[model samples]
Target: MKTFEATARSKSKVDTYISNFMKLHPFAAFLTVFVGGPLFTLLAVAAAVYLIALPLGFIMGWF
Candidate 1:
């Protein structure tokens, strides 16, 4: 018999994971989406174009 390993990008898995996160830390989740999301995006897109952080974000998103 084999057990199923969990994955990160599966739709159902992501949904449940997000719901669990929100349930556990509503404020943190909210701040992540509203604050961290934009800050990271801006840092990666504009501010850090010459830095490793921008490319690292793209690589992580691809994988």
Candidate 2:
């Protein structure tokens, strides 16, 4: 019984925190999906290009 009450209280607190966060920073959630998605993709592509080019540059004596 005590454990059940504690779990309920914890869940209520988490729900309140999520509600407050949504109200406070709605744009943050939007930017995270839209802007951050593309930014991380670009970074990943850039890293891949660098990794591929490193060996090629060494072989071509351009390093």
TM-score to true structure, per model:
0.54, 0.58
What TM-score would candidate 2 get against the native? 0.58
For model 1, the stretches where C-alpha displacement exceeds 4 angstroms are: 1-9, 47-63
**TM-score result, candidate 1:** 0.54
Candidate 2 residue-wise lDDT, 12-56, digit = tens:
999998778868999986787699989999999999999999999
Every model's Cα RMSD, please?
10.2, 6.9
For model 2, which pairs clash? Answer: none
Please provide, for model 1 over 1-63, each residue's C-alpha lDDT reduced to its tens digit, 9 standing for 90 to 100: 123344434667889989999999999999999999999998877765657666787888952
Supply candidate 2's per-residue lDDT for 33: 66
Q: Model 2 segments beyond 4 Å from truth?
A: 1-25
Give the clash total for candidate 2.
Answer: 0
Error of 1 at 27 (Å): 1.0
**Pairs clashing in candidate 1?**
none
- How big is the positional error of residue 17 in model 2, measured in Å on the Cα after superposition? 12
